[model samples]
Target: MAETLRNTLKAERERLDLTQAALAERVGVSRKTINTVENGVFVPSTILALKLATALDRPVEALFQLDDSGVSPKQDT
Candidate 1:
């Protein structure tokens, strides 16, 4: 099984009525970085994740979760 990092970045940013650029500026990152992170194109480092959580006033776990749907059980040979 694989644990993928799924996030609620888009939803959280929207809930705060913040544009990608605005959120990026607040987190000292570029808008592309925010977009990539939100769209799951990029996996943010722990530092970036913490910064995002802090800027959004959300807990790290609230922003991200581990999804195990990427793999399936092994079949008997």
Candidate 2:
């Protein structure tokens, strides 16, 4: 089955005026990972997803979606 991970990371980060590096530091991940996530090249693990949502001050559901009608479907996570 396919899933759609819709993240407001870029939008939230920009709203907070934070760089990807800054977000990465807060989320305890490499900037490259954040870049991949923001670009939809990587789907974060559950823990990583929670960390990112926490850093962005949003709920996990706001950062990641599972339904098919939302963002484009991704290959498996």
Candidate 3:
């Protein structure tokens, strides 16, 4: 499996008291896009990620991270 992009978009958005529609407007995307991202149904583009971080007043790394669940097990050499 490919590494998944984990995010704390929903928590950050709530921390800032912004609704999905509000955050989407700030990022120039549809609310559905934000919802999908929050639900891990979509991986946002780098630009989108930056926009979200900026709007949420957070670093991109704070909002997103790589999950280790997709890592393959090491094989014997």
TM-scores, all candidates, are 0.84, 0.80, 0.87
Per-candidate alpha-carbon RMSD to the true structure:
4.5, 6.3, 3.0
Better of 2 and 3 by TM-score: 3
In model 2, pairs of residues that clash are none
Instruction: List the global CA lDDT of all models.
Output: 0.93, 0.85, 0.95
What's the TM for model 3?
0.87
Where is model 3 more than 4 Å wrong at Cα? 70-77
- How many steric overlaps are in each model, in order? 0, 0, 0
Model 3, 1-77: lDDT tens per residue? 66788999999999989999999999999999999999999999999999999999999999999897868788999
- Of 1 and 2, the candidate ahead on lDDT is 1
Q: Give a tens-digit lDDT track for model 1, residues 1-77.
A: 64678999999999999999999999999999999999888889999999999999999999998676866678999
**Candidate 1 ranges beyond 4 A from true positions:** 70-77
TM-score of model 2 (CA atoms): 0.80
lDDT of 1: 0.93
**Residue lDDT tens for model 2, 1-77:** 56667677789889889999999999898999999998888989999999988888888888777556645657897
Greater-lDDT candidate between 2 and 3: 3
Candidate 2, residue 31: CA error in Å?
Answer: 0.6
